[model samples]
Target: MRLWFLIPALMAAALGARDANAQQVHFDIDATLPVRDTELPYTLDLNLTAAAPTRIGVGALLDLREIQKIVPERMADNAIVDNCGLQVRLDDLSFQAQDETIGLDGGVTITIFECSRTSERDFQRGEQKRAILANMSTQATVDLRNNCAYFKLVDLTLTAPEAQREQLLEDDTLDSVKELMLAAVDLVLNETPLCPELPAELASLDPVYENGGPKEIGDGGLGVFLDGSVDVSPSTILDILTVLQQRKLIPGPP
Candidate 1:
C-alpha cells in the first residue's frame, strides 16, 4: 500500500515538472515576408520592407507598375508610366483574446508614392501625387498552412489629410489601390508565422478551415469562416502560444 501511494505521487510530480518546462521553452519567430505576385490586379514589383519591428510596422511595399496589366481596358486612355507604390505600416498591433485574431487600432498607415500616368495621346506624364494616410484600424486572422502559420488581412480604412483624402477618393484607382495594399499585408502575415516552421510534436494538429479551405479565426477583412477552435494539447501547442501571447502575437484568455 505504501509503495503504491508513492508511485502515483511521483508520476504526478513528473507531469507537473514537464508542464513547467514546456511553459518556459522559448521559440524564435521571424516575420519577414517574401516577394510574391497575385494575378488579380496586374501588380508587379511586389516587395516587403527588409527590416521591420518584430511586433508589426512597415511590413511590406506594393508596387503597381501597369494599369493595363491589372485591367486591359484601362490602357486605352491611360498608360501607367512610373508605377505606384504603397507602404504598409501597422502600429499598436495587438491580438484579441476572446477571438484568436490579431487587430490593429488606428496605428495602420498607408502612404502612397504616386505612380505617374500619361494620357495615351498627350504622351506627357504628371508628377506622382503621393498621399500619406493614418489613423486606421484593421484585423487579421491566423492560419497554419504548409508547416507555418499565416495571417490574413481582413478589415481596412484609408485616411489622409482632407485635401489628399479627397483627391484619392475621387481617383478611379482607389479600389484597386486598397486591394493591393490589403493583399500585400496578408502575404506579410503569412511570412510571419507563429513558428517559422511547425515543430514535429504539433504535427498531429490539422488545419481547420470550415469551408474545406484554409482555417480562419474571424470574419470580414480578407475572408471569413464559421466558428470552431483548434482543440489541442497544452504541452505541444500551449508552449508556443504562451510565448506568442506574451509578445502579442496571439491572444490569451481574457
Candidate 2:
C-alpha cells in the first residue's frame, strides 16, 4: 500500500552551540517523538554524498563525562500522534563546536507497531492504524559562513518482522516507502532554520522548518548519503550559548 509518513517535529528540540573549547560541550536528548502527519508528497530518490570526509564518528559523537552537558527530557512529551500509531525516539544526542560550525548528532528510531483507533466508533469497528519502525542517525552542522546549516543522514537502518519485511519486499512497497521517508527527513532537516536573528532572545530563538532555503544532496548507502547547508545569523553562536544556559544545559552564573 502507498503510505504517506508524517514525521514528527524531529527538529524541534534540537539546538547546539560552541565556545572556545569546542570539544568541551555536551548535551543529550532522549524521548519518543510522536508522528502527526501521515500524508506526504512523494519525491524522487535521494542522491547522497559527503562534501568532505571526517573521522568524527570514530569514538562517539561527544564525550559527556568530561564536559558540562544538558539533557532535555521533555522534548517529545507534546508530540501529536492521533492518526498513525507511530512514535519517533531520539537518543545518544551530542554536540560540539568546531572552528566554523556547530554540530548536532543523534540517533532517531521510528517504530509503528502500536495500533490505535481514532475514536470509540473506530475502535468498535476494529479499525486500526499502525506504523513501521526505522532506525536512523542524523548529523547537522551549522555553518558560520553565510548563516546557514547543513545536515547529513548516516547509518539509516530499517527494521521489521520477517513477515512484514517479506510482504513489502514481495510487493516492491518497502523500497518506495523507504525512499520517501528519507527524502522527507532530508527536507525537514535542511529546511529547519539553525540560527536566530541578531540580539537573540528566548522568544526569537524559535527555529522551525521554513521555505526559501538552500539545500543539496548526493548519493550514498541505503538512502543514507545526504548533505545540505543554510545561512545563519552571526549572533547565533551567542544565542545558542544563552539558550543552553537558560535550559540549564550548562552551569549558570554563580
Candidate 3:
C-alpha cells in the first residue's frame, strides 16, 4: 500500500471513543512503515488528545535518499531558466534537524557546455562538483476541512562553494541559479503532502486547527502539532468502523 494510505489507516485504527462520559480521548501510535514505492522505511509516531478541541502531534523520520529523488523532480517542474548555459545536478544528499531547523548537505555538479563571458574566463567546458549546504526552518498549517497539514518554509540560508559564491557575487545568471536551488527546496517542503486527507466521516468528528508548526524531533526527524475536538458517541464509533470496513482496512462482520 502507498505510504499515504497507510498513514490514514493507522490513524483510523487508533481513534476510539473509549469513555462516553470522559471529556477527552487520546491516541498514541508508534510504527515503522516500509514504503514500497520508495523502497525505504519510515518511522512514524502520532499522539492525539481529543476533546472540545483535539490536540494532535506527529513525528516522522524520513529517508534522505527518498528526498534526493524528489528534489530533482520538483526542480524540473519549476522550469528554472539556464541563462548561464549550465546544467546542474544534485547528489549525496544528507539532512540534520536541530533547534527547529533542518540542515541540508549535498554535492552539486555544474556542467558548462556553452559559451558565456564568465564561464569562458573562470570555468572550463566541463563539470565542477562542489559541496552545497543549506539550512531551513519550517512551519505548518492544518487544513481541518481536508484533514491534512501543509508545511511552509519559514526561513532559508543557502551556502555555496567559494567558486559559486564568487560567481553569484558577479553574475546575474548565477543569482538565478541560487534562486532555483531555494525554489526547489521550497517546492519539496511545501508541495509534498505530509499528511493525507482522512475520510469525511473521520474528519467530521472534530473541529481541528493548527497548534504549532513542525519542530525538530529525535535524531533528524520532524514533528508537527494540531488541535481539534471530537464527539465520542456510539453513532460516531459506528461511523468510523463503517468507513474503515469500506476501505478494507478492517474485516467486516463475519
Candidate 4:
C-alpha cells in the first residue's frame, strides 16, 4: 500500500503565531490497500484537521470475499462432534454486502458416524452437505494505538434453507449446530484484528479517534469510516523523527 499525505501550507501560519499551543497541523491521506497476496483493492480515505480538539475522519471499503479468506476451512469442536455424532468441516465460505448487513454463505460437510462404536475402524456411516446462510450487523472501530481496525458484531441471524431447517429441527440439534457455525464466524470476524499495512510517515502521525466509527455495506464489500485526529506538537514531531530514524529513512543523531 502507498499512502500520500498532503499537509496544507497554511499550517505554517499557526506555528509562527505567538501561542505555540494553538498551533496544529492537518493531514489528508488517500490510498488503495491491496489485500495481502491478492489483487483485490481496498480503498481508504482519511482526513485529520486542526481544531480545538483536532478532528479526524476516515473511509474505507474492503471486499467481502477477502474477509472470507481469513477464516479457517475446518473448524469443529470435539465435544460438539462427539455429542452430535457428526464430524463437521467448513468446505467453502462466501459473502455478500447488503444494505445494512453482510450476508454469509457457508458450505458445510457433515459426516455421520456411529457414536456407539468405539472402534477406530469403519465407524463412519455417511456424509451430508448443507449450505448455511447468515446475515450480520456490524460496527467498525479504528485502533490507532495498534495501527489496525476491528469489526464488532452487532447482530447475527441464521437463514437456513427451508429443507435444511426441517432437517435440523428433526435432528433435534438445531441450537447446537447454529451455535457452532456462528461461533466460527464470530472467531474470524470479531476476534481477528485487521491491520492494513500503512506507510511509516502516516503511522508516525499517531492517528486517534473518539467514538465507534461509521460504515456502509454495499458494492459487494464493507466500507468503514472514522473521524479522528493527529497531534502536531513538539512531542509528535519527536515521535515522527524517532520513527523515521528507526526505519532508516533518515539519519539519527550521534
The C-alpha TM-scores of every prediction are: 0.38, 0.31, 0.51, 0.54
Best by lDDT: 4
Native-to-model Cα distance after best TM-score fit, residue 58 in candidate 2, in Å: 27
Considering every candidate listed, which one attains the maximal TM-score? 4
Candidate 3 has an lDDT of 0.43
Give the Cα lDDT of each candidate: 0.37, 0.34, 0.43, 0.45
How many clashes (backbone atoms < 3 Å, residues ≥3 apart in a chain or on different chains) does model 4 have? 4
Candidate 1: segments with Cα more than 4 A from true spot: 1-99, 106-128, 196-254
Report how far residue 165 has shifted in candidate 3, in Å: 4.7
Which residue runs of candidate 3 sit more than 4 Å off their true CA positions?
Answer: 1-84, 115-147, 155-168, 198-207, 231-234, 239-254
Candidate 2, residues 1-254: lDDT per residue as tens digits?
11121112111112222222232222222212112332211122211111112101101111122221323232234321222444455545554434323344554444444455667756322233344443333343333234333444542444555756776578554454456556666666565423322222523333332222222222111111112322234354355446556766556667
State candidate 3's TM-score: 0.51
For candidate 2, report its TM-score: 0.31
Model 3's C-alpha root-mean-square deviation from the true structure amounts to 8.8
Candidate 3 on 132-165: residue-level lDDT in tens? Answer: 3322222333232354455444443445667566
Q: How well does model 1 score by local distance difference test? A: 0.37
Total clashing pairs for each candidate: 3, 16, 3, 4
